[model samples]
Target: MFKYVYSLVFCIILGISPSFSQHTEEHAAATTAGHEEEKFDIGGMIMHHIADEHGWEFTHGVKLPLPIILYTADRGIEVFSSSRLDHGQVYNDYKNEHEHIVRVNADGTVNEAIHPMDFSITKNVATLMLGALLLILIFTSVSKGYVQNKGKAPKGIQSFLEPLIVYMRDEVVKPSIGKNYGKYFPYLLTLFFFIFINNLLGLLPGGANLTGNIAITLVLALITFLITNLSANKYYWKHILLPNTPKWMWVIMIPVEVVGVLMKPLSLMIRLFANITAGHIIMLSLFGLIFIFKSWAVAPAIGVFALFMSAIELLVAFLQAFIFTLLTSMYIGSAIEEHHAEEHH
Candidate 1:
């Protein structure tokens, strides 16, 4: 009787030991899996926001579409083509009641009743448009007020605007493009204010990447390129075709000079694109680190770094706009200078 009791007790202990060990192993595996899942979810969200269009739709049916300003020919000339404002898509019907639905697909599963994209304009373009409108309205009103005042000391809006106008005229326009600066003052002022406002606007959340879009920056650069070449006197062209060089080196040097002309605008396009894109990417990357760790322990540190970056981006916004405008004015100066008169003497 004693021997049988001992055997029974031994079997029970052995059986329960394996079950406990297995349970512990399973628990550890689940914890690791949860951590991994958390990391992947965070990385994916950050990548989606920072990366270019991937055809993803929102559950609320709001999608931000890239604005197409104009199409271009193979040689980069503007091709006039008409595009539909709403692209023939309807979001909702007010007259008749209809159910709003959307569909989502994930990992072989389908989620139905997902809302479609919102057809309304996005915030980015709206912000840029608003900025432009505000500048125009304020400046126009101030100009009218100044004219009405008949050369008396300025007040109110004019008082604030006069200093900026004078600064651009003396510091930027006069110093860069000399005597003939009056002809280009309107364009220079418009360009400076437009870029400055847009750059500042992009710092706001949900703002569109006005300068980050290479196509938009390319158009602006092209304008500067056209203005420079068109404004160039005979002396400017002579230098390009027949530079002050040894007779034998003309063959190599002329082609190099021509290439440099093309490269100048290309540099402008790259500078704005790279600077804006880099700031956004760095911010997103820092935020991504929080999810990768799968703990609140690291979030505060990441947030601090992100805040620091945001501050730097704010300064970059103004600096980039100013530098671009300054360089453009300098280019115009070289083209329209009194080179011919100097050579003739």
Candidate 2:
């Protein structure tokens, strides 16, 4: 178990080491640059670290600039490296403002009138892509292992993920969705691994807060919304439209039921977004204490607490994934459940 944990951590480092190295290098530069020590802004650092950006700082004075694709009315489209706008520099009559690309006027201000469509792959997007690719690679290898060891015991990554797969299927999804669980198992499994992996990545030293981002959470919730409603049996809609309430109360009950329908997905969105974002914010804030105090002594205490929080966050990563999958299964079950009207007694 400890070996597995160590291996997971090692893979995480290999996945994010380049970006982490440069983030540390950035902080290093900020502290040791030129003259007197500057006052550390804990809030700013936390926000900056958590927020998505344009380029990957792979190392000291090095970056893997992602493509910056923009489309405008006059100019159909343009693609270029984000490096062109590094260090507040201008590129092709445009500048990056807080990771946003916009037209620059000749007078050196943003041309607000010109709204260009940005289709660039930001930091979070890149992280999502990387996470997805990693999942593909992992599951692919596991699939191959299954074939190679047909009658033998599971080996390597296959062994590692088998228990998790079985647990989710047998314990969570099966129980939650009952007989129809198999149909949705694939999606739920994919969702679980995607969120779980990304959450773990976000907890890493320089990982992008991909799962913490509201946009990502919102999209996931919307997907759940679609799946729940689209596959819903007549009983589900009937419950919302014609609840077991007095006829006189239909006016109030109907509106409330309608709102509840929308709130399902809304709650999912806010819960995941708020929880993950809050965790990142708290973790970053805790670590910022060391620099804020400007003392070597602060490191030990903060480090211990940060370690504790790291463990909590690690649990949270898995917990959040489970909660999401469990809730989704429940929602799906509720929608498709066979409802028999109460017999008059």
Q: What tens digits encode model 1's per-residue C-alpha lDDT throughout 266-291?
A: 99889988898777667766655654
Alpha-carbon RMSD of each model = 21.3, 4.8
Tens digit per residue, CA lDDT, model 2, 1-345: 111111122355334211223123224433355645556667666677778889865334656789999999999899999999988898889899888889999888999899989999988989999887777777777778778999999988778777878888899888888899878888888888888888888876567888889999999999999999999998889888987888899899999989988998898888888888888888777766666676679888877887777777877888898899899999998888887666233
The total number of steric clashes, by the backbone 3 Å criterion, in model 2 comes to 0
lDDT score at residue 319, model 1, on the 0-100 scale: 77
Candidate No. with top TM-score: 2
Candidates' TM-scores? 0.67, 0.88
For residue 116, what is the lDDT in candidate 1?
35
lDDT of each: 0.59, 0.78
Candidate 2 ranges beyond 4 A from true positions: 1-37, 58-62, 341-345
Residue 309 CA displacement from its true place in model 1, Å: 2.4
